[model samples]
Target: MDFRFGDEDETFRAQARAWLADRLADDPAPDPRAWERALGRAGWIGLGWPGTDGRGYGNRCATLAQQVVWAEEYARCAAPARLGHIGENLLAPTLIAYGTEEQRRRFLPPVARGEELWCQGYSEPDAGSDLAGVRTAAVADGTGGYAVTGQKIWTSLARDADWCFVLARTEPGSTRHRGLSFLLVAMDQPGRIEVRPIRQMTGTSEFNEVFLDGARAAEVVGGEGNGWAVAMGLLALERGVSTLAQQIGFAAELEKVVSAAVASGAVGDPVVRAGLVRQWAELTTMRRHALRTLGATGDPGAPSVAKLLWGGWHRRLGELAVQVAGAAGAVGPGPWSPERPYELDEAQRLFLFSRADTIYGGSDEIQRNIIAERVLGLPREPG
Candidate 1:
């Protein structure tokens, strides 16, 4: 497949570069609210949404590609990916697909503009990859809404979030994946919810434990008993397009390491240089596959491949940064410097976290099973 963008795309890229040069230079780090407002004003935030159909830029393949280009450029510049991305990337699309007109009107624009931050209240300590097994219950309160009560662990950014797109059991007697419902709950009210920080190896509290105690809830985006479908749809975005963006970001970091190695003569050692080259090739190849998946608008399962590949690659890149730096690398003051405790600390953290990459999205074993049965037509294992 030809991987080239045509002249129109090229022009768009140049325009994007100029925009970043002007806006990004003034603020190296993104202010979530400001950035969202900027994108919303430019009508660039939700490119995939069906366009206004008002002769304005209608939602189309071209719009999505433009956004992808923007994401890639942002990653290239080492910008921080949104911690509230779960709402923007996964939930918002699901809402557009299944939400009532009123629901869509209420949620989408603010999310697009970053006026509100969101988190996923999907994984309880009890139910993770086995999402169908979620035990968070939502019983009708008789007055109107449901009363939700359960604890959700690893709810990323819940501590600073405004709302949470959550999954809870609505029909206690229904079979797995059959009786669940999705709910959007507020994070500000008391007597219903609690947020506690969960510190990671990175020494940052990017995630939190969310406890729901009699929180008010609405029906799933569409209605009850349809949560399973809504969730599966969200997963498609989570595992597929989300991972594509991540691969782009990781590849950018890989390039920075190569540049540092060359400048320091660390590439002088033939073996070290060869290893770096091999790593770069692998990362680049993975990026191409990711981009192709985005272009084709392929299945959500496509993300499994990207995750499996990059999870390992990110860890390797970090380790190599340490190795290439050598004793001096350990010396303080750079991504490679071991002496800089935080640098070394972060490298170590990423290495440990990478081990969970396959498992988190689904699991390496599970992805292989999907390929074998669904993609490869293998015999299914008996229950």
Candidate 2:
């Protein structure tokens, strides 16, 4: 468990840090798309994707540790939140793994260049955690593609996305995980797709409900009726080096919580002080576990374990944040008018947003079930 970065990795880190510093130096409020394009042009977007060109860093082929270094440096620099993460981190890898050559050529470039954006269409109103229970239907449209019809809730960044990778029941009588197909649907087709923002407690709509009525899939990845495997594979990718970068961001948030506690004198309270200490220690342990599991193969339990640890830890951190804020946490934005009304502060937004940390990706209960059934070989829960 050597945590130190090798010499090459350190060199990569220094390069990444310098590039980010130079890019972020000029524009204090750079447009997200512009920033993403800058990163993409600089060949910093897809570190793990194959195929090297003059436009990409893919030529060098970064190792997992190198990817981790870039991720850490990116977070440490507080660069603009990635606008192409769904495309680069999640969908691109899945595409490389399961997509055809044509599909790869068509989709991978935009993602690598940060020119196109993607949103996942997996969770539905009735099938949030139970992905096997997805009811979105994608029937053959007489042509080669399928006509998708259903609603997807909790779709992150759906409003601004150019495309959506959806899990739909391609078979008429399909139930549970069976008969599912992974369909890539265009989001701009007028009258076929709709996106409604889901306003959160934080007064922002980072998530949305997307409705597809006779929407057309551009193509199906991993073949028709084999979506369950593809979807599961994508989920596994969700637990990759990005998790290390995410932990870096979490460390930032935890620092804010501690700083808030100190500024508000909550650190004087023994219980609050102890909670901060425990949180710091747990975050360190989580990072070690994440690093250790980087090269693990064929372990069904790793992703679930990672999810369970981070989800609960984040939820607890949120509670601690609000607790440290004390009475001030109870107050939210004031009424708005023409000019300015109300806005949530950093701590308030953290408390509100982190409320969904345990529920969104996969519920705590679901993660437990996965760990039990797959990892420990325990009996499956009776439906």
Candidate 3:
């Protein structure tokens, strides 16, 4: 594979880098919703959408390489983490692939405009890693829509989202992957949907527990009983273009860790220095692998491999962050109380969040099983 960025890609990269530098130099708003709209208006939102969506929805259909360039530049400039990414990268693409023309027309424009935010309702209290085990049910409401009821756990952006793409059982007596559906639900149904934030040990509520008591699913994508495929496809996207952006963020974290090591004089230890060098080398490898597999949709193993690579790498980096910080990284800034808890510093937050890097999205064990059984054609593990 050619590693070089073509002239056009370089041009796009320059534009992306310049725009990010200018916009990210100062905080425009504390809220990321405003930032999402700004990106939408600039035609920077859906960088990899298919061309000529032509209705002038304002989505820029850049090439795969350009997409990578934009993601890298976006992270390099330390731009605020995108809140619309779930909509633009996952839901929008899934809709384009499997949704009706009306659904696309209704949905894509708002996402491109960043007028809405979306959260995923895939994992349930009982279903998580075993995605097919979802117990959430969606029954026809006798109108054009269906009423969704059940619970979704670890739902990112649930409180702040304007919509949620839910995976639910549509048919009675359905089990596992059968009779499932990909549902598009608006989050504004008052008195029906409830979002209770799950506070993390890091003193943040980035995840939530969502209760849907007859919440309405206004649209269904990929038809009824085909949700497994759609959900897997979305997961594949999660492992694709977004992985590159994640790596860029990982790179930034690594840089900060190194800087912290230097400032703390931990670089004097040969072991610490060696660990840092190993991390740099592994990150470089991951970047190249992501580039090579960026467009390799036929390679079923790529996504799992990418997940495993970054998951373990990030967990180790968290350990190194604490190690390099010596004893100081473990302490909090102030006394803790129910009304006022301790604040986590950058390294502490990194360490705490990274602890789940191997668990969420897909666990490390699950990824290995996927690679082994699906990619290597090995016998399935014993139950």
Pick the TM-score winner. Answer: 3
Q: Which stretches in model 2 have alpha-carbon errors above 4 Å?
A: 1-3, 51-60, 333-342
Error of 3 at 178 (Å): 0.9
lDDT minimum window of 10 residues, candidate 2:
51-60
User: 43-161, model 3: which lDDT tens digit per residue?
Assistant: 99887676344544458778888988888788776678789989988898898778888888888889998898999999998898889999999999988789999999999888889
- The parts of candidate 1 lying over 4 Å away from their true place are 1-3, 51-62, 239-244, 263-271, 295-300, 327-355, 379-383
Model 1 residue pairs with clashes: 325-329, 329-338, 330-338, 330-339
Q: What would the per-residue lDDT of candidate 1 be over residues 1-383, giving only the tens digit for each residue?
A: 34556678778778767776777788877776677666556554555665333332222334556666766666666655565477667777788778776677778777666677888888878787777778888998896678899989878778768889889888878767888888888888786899999866555776789989999886458698789888877776665445556766676666767776787788898987888888878977886787677645545457556666776677678778767666765443445445433543443554556655656656667667666776678898665
Q: What is the alpha-carbon lDDT for the whole of candidate 1?
A: 0.71
**Once model 3 is optimally superposed onto the true structure by TM-score, how far is the C-alpha of residue 69 displaced, in angstroms?**
1.4
Query: Model 3 off-target regions past 4 Å?
Result: 26-30, 51-56, 335-338
Error of 1 at 50 (Å): 1.2
lDDT of each: 0.71, 0.88, 0.88
The C-alpha TM-scores of every prediction are: 0.85, 0.95, 0.95
Top lDDT: which candidate number?
Answer: 3
Better of 2 and 3 by TM-score: 3
| Cα misplacement distance, residue 304 of candidate 2 (Å) | 0.7
Clashing pairs in 2: none
Model 3 lDDT, residue 165, Cα: 98
